[model samples]
Target: MNRLKLISALCLLGATSAQAAPSSSGPIGPNIGYGDASNANTIYDPLANPANNALNAADTEGYRVGLGINAQTRIEIQDLEGASDYYDNQIDPLLNDVANAAQLETNLETFIANYDQGNISTISGVTVPLLIKTDSMAGGLSLDYTRQVGAAGIIIKGTGNVTPAADGTNLTINRGSAALGVTYKQLDEFALGYGFKAVTSGNSALTIGVTARYLTLLSNQNNVDLKQFIDDNATGSANFSDYVDGMDTGSSDSNLTADIGINWMADNYMIGLTGMNLTEPTFKVNNMTSTQTKYDYFSSLVPSDYKMKAQYRVSAQVYSENREWTLAGSYDLAESNDLNNNDTQWWSVGASYATNSAWYIPDVRFGLRGNLIGTEKTYTNVGLTLGFLNLDVATTTTDFSGVEDKQKDAGIMASAGVEFDF
Candidate 1:
């Protein structure tokens, strides 16, 4: 790819786009609408907390099925669009005309120095094509994809020097010193879960549940070289599209993981605890090499082995006597990271109302959620259910001027699905 094309690709890496707070690698649930799921009692619960499958089935008479799709993205930087404009309109052009080396250095330094280094921007989506739940069991399939890009190590201003070729047609920088580190991964899961009443005392029952899933994984870890393409004397010549295709390291692997949970069900209240990724399955992603150039490209660091860390969470709920009104809350007992290694720990609380007697009146749900670790932004959630269809959306309270003077939030999510009971 030509120098300008290469630069353009790099600039789009952190473009002003959607960011998300990924709570689990499961199907979309009521939590996506109400910002909490401890006692929501939905068919898709088994995908998130195995115990929920049987626990929720207890509230129904027969079999249940749910299908859902969810997508979300997050950008925490205050002025990300501005940063892209600075790079595309100013720094990139100066790269080719090395005669203005002094000006190029100044612009590059300013771009790096002003960039947001505090938060890790993320994009994630999950689709649950089908899920089946019975009185004592639940099983389903889910596909999850996540991408995380942190701009921290990409630019080390004082550690390296930028120098242009004597003829001012080419530029050089310390190899491996300036590059964007990006990680993308996807998981396809075939999951099965079972639950049973373990103990009964007074008006409450303690139900235990366990789930195991066969996982198919694909991942890519890329380090984009900023200086390689600018070298006019470089040997390789490829268009921007071809170069991007080559960036995929093409790594795939598989493993088995499991989750366990327990729920104490009572007449008017419920409490639950869930533990996910109990086996701590680990995977590998090929560390992409720098763009092929005549110069040595061995200085780029190899990515570390990535593993799925275990996470624990707790939830509680209270309901009205008629079972029409519900209040729920959920919190993470400890912080964890998603597949892309972004920190995550969330706390959510919300309420919902449904008139089970009427199909014409839509079920209403509202809630709030915030991350305890990364970004730490809070969001307001709203959802509606009409007959067998469901729709949910959530957005952060804070907004920033994005590209073209448009306003955007730090995080947002939308989900839609259908469910039926037989």
Candidate 2:
């Protein structure tokens, strides 16, 4: 049993070697709406103008700054046999032995079943001026400028021990990130956006993206330590300390990446292809030898050194719209990468209805939108746009996996803001 536990721990740690970086943007639901511009908007429609970089003839004069906020929570639990193995190997062997192996198994099963029944993992944050959109129609050509700034973080609670322990305890990892983006659009259809950010203190990089009707491309530079920014801000916290220590300062490398997308509006369809980390760039961290010796050994055993290869993604959307109602469906191809095997490809379908009321308020439009991604997960968004103020709220299954044992891993995300055209 002890040997089994040790083996399990090693396996878990090995698995951690490829944990991919978290996504930098928010969820874009499946719906065709103007609010879909910023990735943060709950509308799922891929055809809708992305809030971050979209510009239209209506945005010709002055500037608009949209302050938006979103909060999301997710929880996962599984009746895992490997928990005991992990506990035995990574945690204290003597604290609690599997005196009654059968009983322990039963208990673990129950825990997994009820893990999300009562427990949840949450991520909450506020983004002010989530996007800045400006456009001008002059010289028979249109110019568009867009910018965004926001902060996000994740907090995980509850546990059946999914990852390796740092100090023989249930891993409690907290991660936070901040990002800023600027995009310029020309002739209402072509765009270029640049993004820079830091995730965990050790990971910092600059990304530049370009997009045209039916196509989008992106690229990035290599790991650049963010501690300098934190230190400059004089906001030193324990999280910052950990981030600084984890940074790989010795390696200075850059990555070349690209993505291409195509949209066919006449047929109510859209398709997109994206490639991430295409440059196969390699950036080495000095502490990797000591902090992650096992990873070093594992890497040596592989066919080649750690090279950042291109990750491919394909997505499509179909929509039908009328004066009072809209329906849409979308599919996103999942990339099979070493870092995230459990991550599966998924699709979403959604519907929405709009009505204008004259009884209570003047010029009031209310809409309800719902989306289902994959088999077991669903999200519904309710919104009201009165005059220049647009308010939206959404509820979604926090857990991406649609398994009953892990069903409790779900929650709601709500956002509200005003978009006024000047």
Candidate 3:
């Protein structure tokens, strides 16, 4: 019931539109990214570098632990409508009916119709340009605790991303809007893992890290074709459950995955290379039998094994004298990773200028983040660090109106965190 899995994710997750904290990636100051090692300390972060891995630019030796909360939400809709309508019509209403399969389909269909219009547009003097890219609307919440003793350290984290895959280049959405008609593929994941990180010594600039996680596959096929249900029984909307008792949407499974990383640093510069789910995780989910509820549609669990793809990233960073000015770049090699296979890969550059000052002045930091090569979105960040607390914010904007007579896509992501060291 893969479709059911999507419904579960959409209904279950409570995270809102926010920034990706990526706590384990270290304090990025005004920089925002998890896969960006060069910008966020990829040299010391295992996931960013994964091969083994750098300089403790902050002299972060001894014992250290950090605790924080992070949330990330990414959504794109046709810039034709007012931003408030997208929320009032899609996000908020769905937030209340997380279990209503029918309602979920209704809202999604509306979203798809609007989005498809943006994908195909013709310039007045040019041939029709087909943008084979999809929009992404994913949200997540995480709680993290990390501790390190000497060069060997451990980090424990729990993660959740709730929302089914909505991005598609040429989605035949109406292709399956019928009740008990088209089956929705399911995909949801939940996990907690302990990561091991360190360099050869306190002063070593080479580092690598690994993490073996207990993964749970909450995604499955979700079959709920309302039109099919109505036609099969030839009955009015009376006693809905009676007509589809056994076809209830609910099914799940679990598995395991690992991450590998490596990185190096020299002078005021750093580089990192890493792989997520390098082994390519998969699930041999139980084949749900299709129970006859409408037409040939059944809510039975269909058995199928799905591949969780792998992702690769490379990053580099440069710092000016006294670490005042910073420039960094990150490239997503897998673009479509197993964890978030639908979201587009982004080639991002983040630059920040931080000034170290006493309590009154605080450390003022500001930077620009954008997909200089991959996608069309651009983000800008501003941050302030007071003692142990850090506050950062960012906004995403895209203008594809050039093809659609001037339509725009816009979004925002923000986060805050604190750290302790001895």
Q: Give the top-scoring candidate (TM-score).
A: 1
Better of 1 and 3 by TM-score: 1
In terms of lDDT, the poorest run of 10 residues in model 1 is 148-157
Model 3 clash tally, residue pairs: 42
| TM-score: the better of candidates 1 and 2 | 1
Tens-digit lDDT string for candidate 1 (1-422): 13444224433444522322234521254557655563334445555566565533234444555555444444433233355557677777776575777887777667656552322344544444345555444322222332322221132223444444434345655453344444555556666667666787876778787777677666665555556545432435644344346433366788988888888877788788888888888887666655466322533454556677788888887887554678988888887776556667878888988544456778788988887886566778888878767777777743434522432325655666665543
Model number with the top lDDT: 1
- Candidate 2 has its poorest 10 consecutive residues by lDDT at 179-188
Q: What residue runs in model 2 are displaced by over 4 Å at the alpha carbon?
A: 1-209, 212-256, 267-324, 334-344, 354-420
**Ten residues in a row with the worst lDDT in model 3?**
122-131
lDDT for model 1 comes to 0.57
Cα-based TM-score, every candidate: 0.80, 0.40, 0.53
List the global CA lDDT of all models: 0.57, 0.28, 0.38
> What would the per-residue lDDT of candidate 3 be over residues 1-422, giving only the tens digit for each residue?
11112222221121211112122212232335332543332111332443322223432232223333222233332233432345355644543343554565556555434432231110000001011101121111112222210000001111221122222211112212322211122333232323223444443356555555444443333334433332322333334233223321456456666666666655577677766665666765433324543322334323366556666777777776344456777777754422212234555566655433233445554555554332355666666656555566666544434322332445344545542221
